[model samples]
Target chain A: MQIYLPIAEMSVSVLLILGMGMAVGFVSGLFGIGGGFLMTPLLIFLGIPPAVAVATQSAQIVASSTTSALAAWRRRALDVKLAGVLLIGGLMGTALGVWFFAAARRAGQLELVIVISYVTLFSVIGGLMLKESIKEFWSTRKGAVRPPRRGGQHPAYMRLPLRVRFYRSKIYVSALPVLGLSLSIGFAGAVLGIGGGFILVPALLYLFRVPTAVVVGTSQFQILWTTLAALVLHAVANQAVDAVLALLLIIGGVFGAQFGARAGRNLRADLFRLLLALLILAVGVRFAVELVVRPTEPFSLVVSEMRE
Target chain B: MRFGLALLLCLLAAGPAGAETLVASLSTSQVRITSNYTGSQIVVFGAIERDAQTVARAGPYQVVVTVRGPRQAVTVREKSRTGPVWINGPQQKFVQIPAYLGVFASAPIADIATPGQRGRLRIGLQASVNAPDITMDRGTEDDRFREALARLKIKELLFIEDERGTTFLTPSLFRTPVPLPVTAPPGDYEVDVTLFADGVLLARAGTSFEVIKTGFEQRLAEFSTEWAALYGLGTAAVALLFGWLATVIFRRD
Candidate 1:
């Protein structure tokens, strides 16, 4: 079916939108990224209003994460207690982010912020990925196995009140750290219109050294709340959420998430990281091009009230 | 047979006084006026040929015009029922529906006076609806107008038809003759004309028009000004807050 979007005045075929959703879902599942980094840009390219695109993406994230989280729980890999602590922090961060968004709107400086942030973040992430991929290629030529970090005592000073053990992750951490992580992910999730799965997964794996099996599950757990909070904030604060568009994307994402989770189980860790690096690089480069090339007319659908 | 001859004799009697052709046309042939409105309006106008028939009836005519468009089209037909209706404000809210004011005719169209020798009536059009005790401010009025235009589904052009004649016009071509009164309620409205023959239903023509508080250019400017600062501060605040929380939660253990 084809539907005409009112704001964009474009005919969007359901099949095309579904295909895009499925493709993003597959990548998200394979690499454990929330897919917002790709989805938002793609929607903008397709002429969806930026605000609507972000809000709708949040709605899709809720569905995608819900499906993925359920599967991870079935595998006995989710650390629910840890996720709870993070969620607490995430909730606070989302509130703060929304406040900041409103302030920026009033100040009339949202676009500059968006452009600068995109360029800086993408360039850094993309450079890192290019470096990692080159290193991997060199390591293959050397034909030497990368040594794993030797087990060592847990660091002090990182300790917080309410220490708890995660049976699934086989680790003990203070609720403070979990709460802090959740807050950070929550803030980022709200601002970027992502579920925070991509960031959370990396934080868990590298910073916390959580086992690979638990990483995806914990990330999904965190993302579920992050996406949900973002969705609610966008709907209430900006009135940007389009329920119909969100429903369509969610329908495609649900099925895709199931397939993605199944495929995720068999993927190699290094290969997954490489794919994530490449995807981030692609997104970063795209944003970079947009920032540098000055268009004759500003590329945007939003009409400002100041012009009148 | 006697009646038929009498009608023919009447026609012959009226045919010779330098007959003028009065051609009437509407901007759109079909319109969808939502029932959520008290009443709606449209515009109907056309050129009169120099040699067409002309009538000397002044403004007042009990005109009944039936407008048919898509069934899903919401016309300005509102009932006095108590229910929740969405109201546009700083924050959109659902309020108990009030008695919606129906359509109002601004001026009993003065007269279909012939233009020079031509039987053309090039007259300005205006209509309004009132909602007493209902605040019809600029914002609300624009919102209602936008909603009506959206319902009109006029992508490129609209066709108008009536007993006088039928005409097609693009939305961009129609011009507003007067400024919209600030007190007007938020509702659908159009410029329209009603035709009457011996005080009976003849034809009606109209076209959808909108009154916007802010033009397109102004909106673009405001968006650009606000977008830059907000996006940056919002992004950083988010990144830092989330980063700190992540550090606190996932410390090395």
Candidate 2:
């Protein structure tokens, strides 16, 4: 059950990697997120080089997101026009992210920046989700007035300069904040080497008041394309993609995604949000603890380049 | 690298080589890294051969075997806690140092050879790391950074030393095993077997082997670098294929 990864230059247990992939895939299907936020860190923890782990993970993300994204699309739950705008902003962010990533690396603070960003993103996003979901759960139990879902009840800040109508979400909101939201998401995604699905899903629901189900589909659609772009970039820049490893992950991931998507439909939206909020906070707390605890080994080695 | 070994062998043979000359062979000269390759061990079997001018010695002969993997540049970075978080501080780069180094001796290297002799011959782990070839990127060889590098490598199972790793089968014959960890990179590795008696170097012999990725692993690694874009597209296609298959099997809408 031991297999050697070609590009990563490491030997890993097949079953262990399969299990990790399946777990991420389940998250992908259930939440309509790429799950790269979890998968990348897990890969690095298993001793895969950071560069290789980041590059190779895109393939797994593509597989997981596509499985759920395509399903949502077939069910007519995805918003293509909205996702398209987000894609444009994401691409712009990717270019900026890569340049900044290189600069941070040159300063030898890339690891610090990545860890800090992870802690900050996870806590803020997870904290807000938990708070809102708890309130939503209680309000429903009391039979109180539900939060507004239809568009046009916009706050002053959301009423930006240019207005565009999204027919699917029934929103006549400005495109500026939407574009800006995606731009920042993309930048964060590139810096963290993740798909940004977790953040995207929540942002769509809170900011645009996108329907619960549609938010899943749209975020997944966006994740699929961004991960594909990332895969190609890593390939061209570092040639770090390990095809064999990715294939193993995909085999397990696709199976897990099927079951997870089915389970997602049966679960209530409030309960789903509660679980996701817990998961996100758990990951955040884990990283935070790592930062505080004294490391067993404080020195690490980085090879300059591979030699033939 | 092979030429360097050959030159070292010639110089050793031409040196004050007494009657006894070391002869050595390897269990495997080429390790093909297949899909199932985790790690492996290679044995060094050698004998002492003497010519007509052979003479009996007052003390028993001791053997020391050193196996070194290919040289590579590695940057060792140090991290110190800043408030609640530990952040990387100053770093040093080890230029063209052996990626893997293992020393196996019949007795403790220090017990068998004097510090001066060990340093001159690069016979032990300390001498190997502190050899004249080792150079840092910045500042002096502040013992702290170099020690940390050695310590980390040892923890990773890349740098090793076993005082009793070598054993003598008979008076003039011996054998030792060199272990290659899963992390061992594919490269050319050199094996040096030195004969010592009463803290004096007698004879030395050297051999080499290669660790290479063969069959599927080899081609995939090459394809990724040579046809980078195509490789990426191919992996993406496979993912898409799997994803589509999932949808078909679990169709529910």
Candidate 3:
């Protein structure tokens, strides 16, 4: 069953990587999140180097996002104009992120920074989602308001230049907020080597008060570009991409994304958040353990003289 | 005068009376080393031969090659193999060592050496081995020894295995015997080959090679050119800020 991959230079069957991609892609589609957060760690566990896994995962995200975004767009759920504005910010943020990433590498603290950021962000976000889901579950049992909507006036601080009205979401928000959110997600995407759809989906749903229907589509739209940009940058700068591994994951992810998008329609907002939170916490803890624990023996490889 | 004549006659009788002529040759005298972002493996080949019958018994020799330059020294060794193999019909028979094809060892390089400089190294050849088996038919003991041999790493095992029995070492005919990087620092190095028979050193030989550096700065310039995109993006961020600021300042009420 072993096949030697030309790019990876390792004996790994395509089927095995595809199966892993399908599982991760399913979750990504269902939750409107990029599965890079989970897939990268899993690849590393399977002995792929961290840099290769991240680069390959970025390529896989393109497949997953395109498949899911198509479905959400067909449902009349995408806000194209808004997503465009966000992309402008995302592109700028990604540039800054790469510079920061290179600086961190030179400082020899890249791993520590990535580990700490993942744990802190996931812990806070996951805890909030779990609490909200529990409250929503109890309220539903008591036959409380079905899909409760906020009634208070929107915050004034959110106002800025380039005000745009989104008719479907029934809101007029400044482009500045959208741009700022995109930049933040873009920075996260670049540093963590993820698609940043997880953060974008939640921000659109809650902070921008975009309808849940439009959030998935718009987030995917922005994520697609961001992931592509990151992939190109990583490839050019670090030569980190492994095309063989990326193709293996994409084949399964494309199909899984479709099913996930379909299931996403039925899931409640609080429940989806809850699942995301739990996944983030689990991955965070695993990363923490790796940083804390040291291996028994340290081995070094000796490089012989190179032949002309 | 009689004592002096006796001494001269004794010296003449003992010197070069029954010396065995052995020659060591490689396939190639020069090897080029290139920069590798990832690790690479290189092969070295050579052989040794003795004059017919003059070499009554030869074996268990060590070949050592040292890479010299930049305060770092790398050495490679080939150890002799001795064990039992299961033959036809479940019978265990000890195989004789092959004589034509000698030892082959591969070394993996994880990092590229600083290249573009000519360096010299020495290759030394010597004979060394453990005591031979005492029993005529050590069946179970030979099995145990084989098992132990299997557990040893590549560095521990010296002989190359094939369908035939073990043979005496032979010179490798490959074009490049050593893997040298283009960025290798300039220095002198040596290669040593030794022949041993039953733990006794019989003959030794050595050779040398040099590493030279060339066109290093030009390569660095190309690297900087490719990396300019990162710098371009950083400076453009300020332009983006200014555009945003202009939009805010020139907004229509």
Candidate 4:
């Protein structure tokens, strides 16, 4: 059951890796999240080198995002124009992210940055989701008049710049902020080896007032491109992408995605958000505890490039 | 014929009288690292070949066997809690740290030889690593860093030391088995067998083996290193293709 990963230079159990992929893929499908927030930590815990884990996880994200996004597209849930603009910004961010990643790696701070970013982002995002979902649940129970306009209702902000219409989401917003938002998301995705869907989905819903149905598809589209950029950058710059490990993950991920997308349709929005928030919080707390607790072994090792 | 005889006699006169000799061989010299290679076991068997000094003449024999992989540089860092978070603190850079090391001795390493002798021969973990390049002068801090490196390597199962790892079939013949984990770096590895008798060095023998990647695994590693840009493009293209294929095949109306 053990397989040797050439790039990672380690032997790992086949079933264990597959199971990890399936679990993460399922989450990806269920919530339209890239699942990197969970998968990257799990891979690191399983002894995969941090660089290889991050780079390889991006490949897996590419596969799962495609699977789920295609399904959404078939259902006419995607805002093609909006996703395209996001893709352009994402590519720009990817370039910057790759440069930053290389610098951090050379300084031996890549792992620390990854852990800190995950803890900070997950806690903030999770806290917001939890609060919002609780209020939404109560509002529905009380049958109160729901706010029809959320993100698109900002009249003053909408008046400031050249507006572009997103026909699918039924909004006229300035392309500048949309481009800026995607740049940040893309930067995060490349650097963190994530789809950035956790942030993207919520941003689309609250910031742009994108329809929930369109949000998932559009984020998936952006995720696919951003992760592809990350995959290429890591492979070229670090040579850390383990092809065998990525294949194993994709095998499990592709199958799990279908079932996840199907099941997601049956879940209530408030309940789904609550579950996602809890999951994110769990990961954040685990990271925070690791940072606070004294390590069993205070010493660590790194192989430096051999002098010629 | 007369010149040959004189030359032989001259060589013999210059050589030590009744010197004990050692001969060794590995079960296999080349370890082929295939795609499914998780690890490998190499059986190192050697014998103390006696010439003028018979087995009975010399004291009971002892053998110490060690296999060292290619040398490389490594950085060791220590982490300490800063406020609510743990961060890397002091760091040391060490050159000539072997990527892999396995030492097996028939008897306790301490019992085999004197500390000075061990250090001279680079026999054990403590004696093997060269002095690290520590910029700051902190007494005993260098030793602490070196020890930490050994401990961390041991925890990873990369560096191993077994006092009774070598088993003797006969008084002069011995065998030791070393398991090379998948994490073992691929390179030329030198195997050294030192023969000892009553804490006195008898003879020494050395041989080398290679751990190399083969087939697709070899080619892939090479391509990634040699033509990284192409490799990156290929990896991205393949991943994207696979994603597209999955989407198309699993498409639902």
Query: DockQ: which candidate is best?
Result: 2
Task: Put the candidates in DockQ order, highest first.
Answer: 2, 4, 3, 1
* lDDT per residue as tens, model 3, A32-129: 78788889878876656566677668777776776666666667687888888889998888888888999998986675577678767767666666
Task: Record all residue pairs in model 2 with backbone atoms less than 3 Å apart, i.e. clashing.
Answer: none
- lDDT (Cα, tens digit) per residue for candidate 1, span A1-308: 66543223233667878888888776766655678877887887775767778866776666676666666776788888777777788889778777877787688565456556666665676577567667876897799777765654566624567778777787777767767776876776555555666667666765576887778877776776666656666655665555445656666665666677768888777776676667776777776665555434221112211110
Name the docking class for model 2.
medium
Better of 2 and 4 by TM-score: 2
lDDT of 3: 0.53
| Chain B TM-score, all predictions listed | 0.25, 0.90, 0.32, 0.87
User: For candidate 3, what is the interface RMSD?
Assistant: 16.0
Candidate 1 Cα misplacement greater than 4 A, ranges: A4-11, A129-137, A153-163, A236-239, A299-308, B1-47, B51-206, B209-253
Best by TM-score: 2
What are the root-mean-square deviations of the candidates from the true structure over C-alphas? Answer: 16.0, 2.6, 15.9, 5.1
Q: Whole-model lDDT, candidate 2?
A: 0.85
Give lDDT: candidate 2, residue B232.
90
- Lowest lDDT 10-mer window, candidate 2 chain A? A148-157
Docking class of 4: medium
Best model per lDDT: 2
* Candidate 4 residue lDDT tens string, A25-126: 888888888888788879988888888898888888888888888888888888899999888887787678878899999998786898789789989988
Model 4: pairs clashing at backbone N, Cα or C within 3 Å: none
